[model samples]
Target: MPLLAGFATSLSLIIAIGAQNAFVLRQGLRREHVLPVVLTCAVSDAVLISGGIAGLGALLTSSPLALSIAKYGGAAFLFTYAVIAARRAVRPGAMSPADHAPAALRSVVLTCLGFTYLNPHVYLDTVVLLGALANQRGTDGRWIYGLGAVAASFAWFFALGFLARKLGPLFARPRAWQFLDAGIALVMTTLAAWMVLPAH
Candidate 1:
């Protein structure tokens, strides 16, 4: 029962669309850098999820001032990303006239890096909060909880990236790109606000 509960909770936490998922979907729809982006996201999540399960989150949470800094930092990053996404929507980017697409491998690598490192939200939610949540289950259930979280990350990333690629052609329309970019901006702005909320 505890394992099941933990799994459910973890799934719920991960299911929400967020910065990482946003980047993956965007890249996938562009069909610019599929494998590298997918792989980087998966690998980064694996490492952070592992660290959270290992209880390193304790140190992060131990300092109230540090936590505040992290939250504010995350908020700033999200807001900045929101602006960039909006700009892209208003002015969509294109690959070089000669090149078919932005170097797929490099693009994916960089996007993944941004999702994992630059986006402060990733660290706060995945590392600190998830770690704290895992610890609540006690030593016996901790591993199971961590497993569930890991599963959620893997399942979501693979499924979203796969589906997004399939839908890439549909997004080829100019209006579709606008809609996606707008959606990205909206999500980022909302998340940024949420992060800075009083109770947050």
Candidate 2:
């Protein structure tokens, strides 16, 4: 019961539309650096979820400085990525999968790291929220619950990154790519704004 609950809860949190998902979809569609990106996301989630199970969530909440640093740093990175996506939208030339040059592995891995770590929400969702939720199962059930959550993470990332190739037909046109990049730019900018703005 705890395992199923954990899987459902973790899937609910992760499967939502977000910057990281958007990036993964884009890369998967392009068929570029998919393995590394998927692995990075899954591993990051595992580490974070483990930390949460270990009670890092409470520690994170009490550390205002750490949260602040993550907030500003993430916002800056998002804004930068937004600009790049916007530029791609304007060009709309390399949108064709056949003509596109694959990005370097090093750069791809770094960007994946940034998207996974720089976002404050990742910590909140994985460590604080999930940790607290898992602990609800008590000591015996907590680790099992956490294992379920970790399994969900692995399943979701791999499916998203690998299964995205099926979208090849839909994204074939340059216009489709333009629209996708435009959407990405919009999402990134909005997230960046949300990061800096005061809560209501």
Candidate 3:
């Protein structure tokens, strides 16, 4: 029961639209660096969830300064990415699955890391919220709950990254890519603005 609860809770949290999911979906559609991107996200989630289960969430609670730094830094990175996406939308190009020139492996990996690490919400959800919930499960069940959460992370990322290829036909057109990038830019810009705005 605890395991299932953990799975459901984690899935509910992660399935929400966010920068990480958007990036993964785009890579999956492009058939570019899907494995690395999926693995990076999954593994990063696993680590964060584990840290939460291990009581690192308390540390985060006690350290507002750390979160503040992440907040500003993440917002800046998101804004930069949003601009790049907007530029792509403006100068639209053919991005067929077969025609894309593969981005360098290093560049892809670094971008994946940025998407994973720079998001303050990732820390808040996986570390503070999930950790608090896991601890509520009591000592014996907490680890089980965490395992379920970890499993959910792996399942979500792999399914999103791999299954996204099925949409290849829809995104084959350059105009489709332009529209998609514009949507991505909009999402990223909104998120960045939200991050920097004063908390009430």
Question: What TM-score fits each model?
Answer: 0.79, 0.98, 0.97
Against the true structure, whose TM-score is highest?
2
Model 1: number of backbone collisions: 0
- Better candidate by TM-score, 1 or 3: 3
Report the lDDT tens digits of candidate 3 across residue range 11-62: 9999998888999999999989899999999999999999998999999889
lDDT of 1 by residue, 25-75 (tens): 877776666667777876786688668878777776778887687678878
Ranking by TM-score: 2, 3, 1
For residues 81-141, could you state the per-residue lDDT of candidate 2 as single tens digits? 9999999999878678788678999999899999999999999999999999999999999
Ranking by lDDT: 2, 3, 1
- Candidate 2 residue runs with Cα over 4 Å from true position: none
Q: In model 1, what are the clashing residue pairs, if there are any? A: none
Estimate every model's Cα lDDT from 0 to 1: 0.73, 0.94, 0.91
* Model 3 root mean square deviation, Cα atoms: 1.1
lDDT of 3 at 74: 96
What is the Å distance of residue 71 in model 1 from its true position? 2.3
> Which candidate wins on lDDT?
2
Shift of residue 141 alpha carbon in model 2, Å? 0.6
